[model samples]
Target: MSEPAMSEVVANLNLVRERIAEAAVRSGRAPDAVRLVLVTKTVEPSRILEAVRAGQADLGENKVQEGGRKADALAGEPVRWSMIGHLQSNKVKDVLRFADEVQSLDRRSLATALDKRLQSVGRGLDVLVQVNTSGEASKFGLTPEDVPAFLKDLAAFETLRPKGFMTLATFTPDETEVRRCFRLLRDIRDRARQDAPQGDTLTDLSMGMSGDYQWAIEEGATVVRVGQAVFGPRPLPDSHYWPGAAGTA
Candidate 1:
């Protein structure tokens, strides 16, 4: 597929930003309260560079290898890489090579692996715990009931900082259901904060995407991972990346 023209990409980005601003205002939050992480899963490097030139520095990727490649290629740029997809323990090292943050941390084992890897580099990483608020069997995240214990366990990993929580809402046209998922995530974040360690700063709620980011912001999202709205639609089907996303797109 041909790459989108830079002008077109910029225009789309402005539109998305406008929506974000509107959402923030509606929620009585400052426009800067939410951060936009452009998801570049299957997008070409050249197009991503265009976005960088256009002033989008935060980029998100679903796969470690793919994100690693982009990070290497754009090494000198002022971009910050974020891992916003389910991560495997074996890929922790690769992810650390470029990712400034990981927004999909779920289980204790993954945290253990990440902490070990960070220890090797003498560095630390910001992470958001992924929660399966929608209750989708195919989704990878800690169940709502399991998040408190997971958050407590994460305190042991000094190298991994808990930044808050991340979640994927149910993929459906029904606005009520989608908002419910976002609300649940926000509630989880609120509850987790009570028992979180004094040093563990849980502040970010990474929710929403191309389809429902505005609703997410309204429901208290501090970070929104957007793709199609800014970069144009991916050539592949959404189901290829997310099981129930095809119909929503």
Candidate 2:
């Protein structure tokens, strides 16, 4: 596939920002309340740099290796990297090298690994717990019912700061179903805030993506991981990463 022209990239980014502002206003929130994390899973580094030069600063990737490479290539550029996919314990060190934040933190073991590695370097990293609100088998996140206990356990990891929660809503055309997933995540965050010791600091809700970010922002998403909306559609199918996305897309 041909790379998107810089103009096209800039245009798409502006449009996504407009939509984000509109959604924030509709929800009675400030436009700056929502942060856009551009997902560059399969996008080339050169094209991603085009986006960086165009004013995008936060870039998210699903795989540790791929994101590490991009971070290395753009070492001097002012961009923040986020790991937005399920992470394996073995890759924590590599991920820490570039990932400013990990949005897919779902279990205690992963947290343990991250904390150990961050302690080795005497550094701290931000993280958002991933919740599988849709209850999808293929999705990787803590069950909504398990989040409170998870958050309580997370308080032990001093180096892994709990920034907020992240989730992937159901891939569906039904607005009601999609909204239900987002609402579940928000409700979970609210309840956790009241119950968990560290919940007060869990302010960021990393939800939404290219297809449903507007609805996500309306439901209280503080950070939206958008890809195709700003970079154009990926050459590979969405189902390769998200099951059930083919029909929805």
Tens-digit lDDT string for candidate 2 (147-235): 88888798888898888899888888788998899999899888888888885897888888888999999999999999888777777
The C-alpha TM-scores of every prediction are 0.93, 0.94
Candidate 1 stretches with Cα past 4 Å from truth are 1-6, 198-200, 242-249
Q: Give the 10-residue window scoring lowest on summed lDDT in candidate 1.
A: 240-249
Candidate 1, residues 139-192: lDDT per residue as tens digits? 788899998777778778899888899998888879999999999988888876
Pairs that collide in candidate 2 are: none
C-alpha-based local distance difference test score of model 1: 0.86
For model 2, state the Cα shift of residue 112 in Å: 0.9
